[model samples]
Every structure is written in C-alpha cells, then in structure tokens.
Target: MSVTRTNPALTLGKYVALLAYLLFALFPLYWLVKIAITPDRLIFTEGTDLWPSTTTLDNFRTVIFQTDFMAFFGNSLYVSLGTAAVTTILAAGAGYAFSRFDFGGKKIIVAVMLITQMFPLLMIIAPIYKIVASLGMLNSLTSLIVVYTAFNIPFATFLMQSFFDAIPKDLEEAAMMDGCTRFQALRKVILPLTLPGLGATLGFVFTAAWSELLFALMLISDNESMTFPVGLLTFVSRFSVDWGQMMAAGSLALIPSCLFFIFIQRYLVQGLTSGAVKG
Candidate 1:
C-alpha cells in the first residue's frame, strides 16, 4: 500500500504564513534599532526610512557616562536574577508536590493560586505598599526581589508542574529500584530532562522582573535604587523630554535580556517531552 505525502502547496502556504509572522514580530525590534542608530538631527527628518541617513554612537556614550544608566542596569540585573532564583526554587518544590501528591485542600489551594492571578495587580498595590512599608522594605532592592518573586511564583509553579507531569513516573521508580533515594532520582533522572522547562521558566521570570516598572516606581524612593525601566522615566524633563537618551537607555536595556535568552536558547530547544508518552 502507498501512503500519500502532504501537498506541496499546503507546505508552501505554511512556510509563507510563518515568514509573515516572523516579519510581524520582528518589525518592532527593527524599528528600535533603527531609531537608536539614527542621528538626533535625522530622527524626525528621516520619517519611516528603513535605514538611517546618519548614524552615531554618541547617544550610547552619553547614556553610559552622563547618566546613572549602568547603576540602573546593575540594579535590574540583581532584582531579576534574585527573583528568578527564589521563584524557581519555590516553584520547583511546589510543582513537585502538586504533581506527586494528593492531599486535603489541594483543590482549594490550586483554586486560590488561580484566583490570585485573576485579580488586577493595581487593585492590590495599595495593600502591598502598606505591607512593605510596615516591614520597612521600601526603596530597597530586597523589596523588589521579594515582590517580583511573590508575583511570579504562582505562574512559575504551574509551568514547573506541567513539566513535571510530562516526565515519566517510571523513571523515578526504576531509579529507586536501583538503590537511589527519591531526591537522588529526581536529581539524576529527572532534572537533566527538565532543563528546557527550567530554562524557559527562568527566562520568563527574568524578563518579567527586568522590565517591571510600576512596582519599582512605587516601592523605590531613592534615585540610586531605581531599576532600568523606572530609570528610563528620569530622562523625561519638565519641558523637554530627552528622547535621544531615553531611547538609548531603552536600547541598551534590551542587551542583557537578549544575551540571557541567547545563552539558554540552545538548552530550551531540546524536546523534554520526547519520552513523556507511550507510543
């Protein structure tokens, strides 16, 4: 018996659709780079030009030397990394429990977590501010890290639980039969397989914390403690906004996130679900 292959026209159409989506998603990034490179004098004059008539590194130089750009970048990095680490650890534990155990109020706990995500963050900002103030954590990087971790944990836990659920319970059972403890089985047999999910969770949480501005703005009072997103607002003057510097800082802020994803994109591509299902 002969089997028919997919129609070439259908394959071609799918490729065209994918290419269109790629262009749509990438156009904004292209605009950012275009604007960042265009000279201040040519910014408005070159309206809609694909290429800049003139390019200069002066904006980047001024952002680096004349402003607190580096400090803000460092602060953002600290908070993002801290939040990712803490949230990942907590989520991993919670996800494992959710995946492996059945206990009283499990449904209620999951429902509550889902409910927490349903509320608009703005609604809780007042209560959060009061709590942070009572704890004397305002204007501190620790406060930012804590808040970001708290907000990110529920989603990250769900992410981790999905990954854990995709893993085979048979592997752990076999490992235990081979004289390994549950923790050892998880470490050796499961963790290596879950690298893609971990990388994705880390990337998501890091980006979320890195670009967060509202909470950072409300919780921080000191200029020195401002994150890069909040610090971008500093470029705005009462009369004239520093468009050049703000865009420069904004462009610079993209570097770390880009670099982070680049570093993890390899591990993130592996199909952790390959052995998850029986044929």
Candidate 2:
C-alpha cells in the first residue's frame, strides 16, 4: 500500500520534470509562433508574456502574399527534389555495388569516400566556386543541385549500403536460379523490397538540400535563382530587420519540410530495422 502510494508521487514528479524539459526545449518554437502571430504593435509590449492578449494573421498574410516567398520556395523545392532524386539513385547504385561485389581497390575507394566526408565543407568552398565558374554555371539552380548531390552522395551511399547489406543474398540467388537475370531480379524483386530504404534516403537527402544555406549563398546570386534560405537573408540589409515577417516566413517555410516527413514517416522508422541484420 505504501509503495503504491509512493509510486504515484514519483510518476507525478517525472511528469512535471518532463513537462518542464519539453516547455524549455520548445520555448523558441513557441516564441516563433508567438511573435509571428502577435500584433506588430504588441510584439515589443507583450514581449515577456506567455500568451499574447491578441493574435493576428497579418504576418503570415504578408509573408505569403506580399513577399517573394513563393518564388524562393519554388526554387528551393526544385533544387531539393532534384538533388534528392539524383543523390538517391547514385547512392543506391554505389551502395549495391559495394554490398554485392568484391572488387579491386574496393577498400581504397570506400576509404576515399570516407575521407571526403571527414573534411570540413568550408575547406573546399573556394575550389568549388572556381570549378562552378569554370563550368559557367554560377548563379544557376542546376549548379546548386549538382553541388548538393555530390556533397550528399558519400554519406548517402553508406546509408544505402547498410540497407542493401540487410537484405538476404539468397533472395537474389533464388531469382537467378529461376532464370531471371540479375538485373531483372534487382528490378522485380530487390527494388520493391527496398522501398523503405529509398524513401529514407530520399527524405534525408531532401531535408539536407532544403536546409543547406552556405553553398546556396556562395553559388546563387541572381534574385530569380535565390533559394529560400538565401532569400531569408534578403530580409536583412544595411537597415533594420523585420522580425515578425522573418519569423512568419520561417514558420511558413516549415510546411514543406513537415510534409516531406509526413510522406516518409513510415519508411523512416522502418529504415532502422532494415539496417539491423546484414545478410
């Protein structure tokens, strides 16, 4: 009876602690939502209030209808999708080769890939800029897509290799034994089963491409070509910043990323288990 009574108190304490931690961690997002909705006049006045006395949609309205957010959004979407698709395809092929083949210099190739990942991205910024300029692809969205695809491929290949390694080789051999070519087995059998891995890789590469800013800033300068992350910088200048509108745009920016995850949530969790047992 005493233990049972004490258990409730412990559980209550844990809940209180968890609630505190959650509120603390989520405070910035809460503040973002708060400021985005707070009347511009009241933003400074109610700055410390937990809840604003009144809220408005003016900021969101301004960001969506009054700004170049839509164009920036479209550009970002195009680059991110292109990068994700290409990176996933390349990573899938490389991963398959790594998982299924024993080749000369396989370890050396993998070691080089790993080494590329270990270097700071900042170290190669100048060289990349030079290469992009030499190709005359500066200020182009295609350039961003190509750069992002290359940068993401190594890590993504490792991730794909893990997924491929998990599937049983016997499955492929069985298909071959029944008169199917390896390519046919890969397409008709392995491809269908690899949906989760593909989705996970697609989601990862997409998210990385969506959020990338430094490279976008370096490569794209044309107003028409600027991605959303770079456009966010346009919110600032030699003058004061528009905090409310910036936050509003930021809040709106989250929607696509949220949607991407919504589409991948099933595969995201399953990818964990998919990599557990390598056959």
Candidate 3:
C-alpha cells in the first residue's frame, strides 16, 4: 500500500483562514469585554486604543448591586425557557406527523407557516400590540412565552422535520415489530437518536427569545416584567448613555447564553459531524 501525503501549503492556508475567521468573529466580543473593563472616564479618550491604561470593576459592581439587572435577567430566562420548551414540544409533534403520515392540506399548512415567516415582523407589531392589549396580556411573561412560541414554531418545526427525515423509517417500524408501541419506540429509540437535533432547536429558540428587543419593548412597560433587552435600554437617557455600565451589563447578560452553549456544545458537535458523514 502506498502512503498518501497532504500538501503542507494547503494545510497552512486552511489554518490561516480559520484563524482569520475566528479573529473576525471574536473581535466585537473582545471589544465588548474591553470596554466593560475600561474606566468610564477613559471610554472616550482611549476608546480606539488596543488596550486601556487603567480598568475598573465599578461598572460591574454598579450594574449588579445598584440596578435591577438580576430581575430583568430572571424574567428573560423565564420567557426564553418557556418559549423554547413549548415550541420544541409542539414542533416535534408537528414534525413527526409531517415526516410519518400523509394528510390532506399538509402542503397548504406548510405554505401558511412559511408565509408567516415571510411577512416583516414590524408589520405585525401593531396588530400584536392591539391583540395583547385586548386580551389584557400586556406586561405578562406568559404572554411573551405564548407570542414567542407562536413565532418560533414554524422554523423549529422545519429543523425537527429535517432531523426526523434523516432517521430511517425502518428503525421505528422494526421497534414496533418487536412489540414496541409507536410512542414507546419514539421515547426510547427515536428521541435518543435525535438528542442533537433537539439540543440545536432548543438552543436556537432560547437565544432568539432571549435577545428579542422590539416585542419586549412594546409589550412590557412594567419594569418588574421587563426582560434583559428592554432593561438594557434603561441605561440610556435623552442626555447621555452610560457606556461602561452598559457594556458591563451587556457582558453580564451574555453569561446565560454562553453557559447554554457550553452545556449543549457536545450535542451540537456530534450532530454536525454525523450529518457530514451521513451526507
């Protein structure tokens, strides 16, 4: 057998490209952390510097102790988790139906879901506001959960359907042949295989719900119910914006999403690698 040799130049080029992409993507995040640590007084004077001469933790101290950032974070967490759970459950059921059964008007139903995604979100904000007000759900976390689930279900359904399609029907059928019920097969065999897909869908929906600003701003006027995105706006005023404190708060806000990804990274990696090999 002959040994294959890889080109060193091509390998070097790939590493260089990856490093460049990483730097580009991470640069903004680095800047956010940098500004968060920089003193407010130096924020303007040394804003463009690669490094600040002095740094302080006062910004973080103020954001955590002096403000209601924690409350806003908790509210955001509740809404995001609720939305992700509800959407994932509904989407999984819907996707399973679409993948396994032939039903009349299925195409029409899918078309409608796609159409909902097509309309500019801004166009429906007014109608959504009116409906929330009429239902007396304004400033309610449950209302945010409901609205977010409704908006996210279509896309999440598609993602689940793709994963289900990747799975072979023969596996489920064989489980049934071996005395397993459909639901039993789903719970034991199918779901285990789809863990990666589930993780991906959950992560996507959680991040979206967490970061949504416009709807949060429109629907929640009560400070107690305000999510992190809306609460961040309080750092701004007509006359001035608190740059250091705002950056500090923003960096702190990133913790949940960061931890979420860290928890799910294994599943995400497995999913991508499996997809690549299977494809």
Which candidate should be chosen as best, given lDDT against the real structure?
Answer: 3
Candidate 2: stretches off by over 4 Å: 1-13, 262-279
Best-to-worst TM-score order? 2, 3, 1
Candidate 1 regions exceeding 4 Å error are 1-23, 237-240, 261-279
RMSD of each: 4.5, 3.5, 3.8
Candidate topping TM-score: 2
- lDDT by residue (tens digit), candidate 2, 1-279: 455455787899999999999999889878888888988888778967988899999989998998888899999999999999999999999999999999999999888887787789989899999999999999999999989999989878887888888899999999999999998998889878888888889998999899999988998888899899999887655214576788888887788888888987876655545333321
C-alpha lDDT values of all predictions: 0.82, 0.86, 0.87
2 or 3, greater by lDDT: 3
Candidate 3 error regions (>4 Å): 1-19, 262-279
* Local lDDT at 257 for model 1: 88
TM-score of 2: 0.89
**Which one wins by TM-score: 2 or 3?**
2
- Using all chains and alpha carbons, the TM-scores for the candidates as numbered come to 0.84, 0.89, 0.86
How many backbone collisions does model 2 have?
Answer: 0
Q: Between prediction 1 and prediction 2, which has the larger TM-score?
A: 2
Model 2: how far residue 148 lies from native, Å: 0.5
Residue pairs whose backbone atoms clash in candidate 2: none
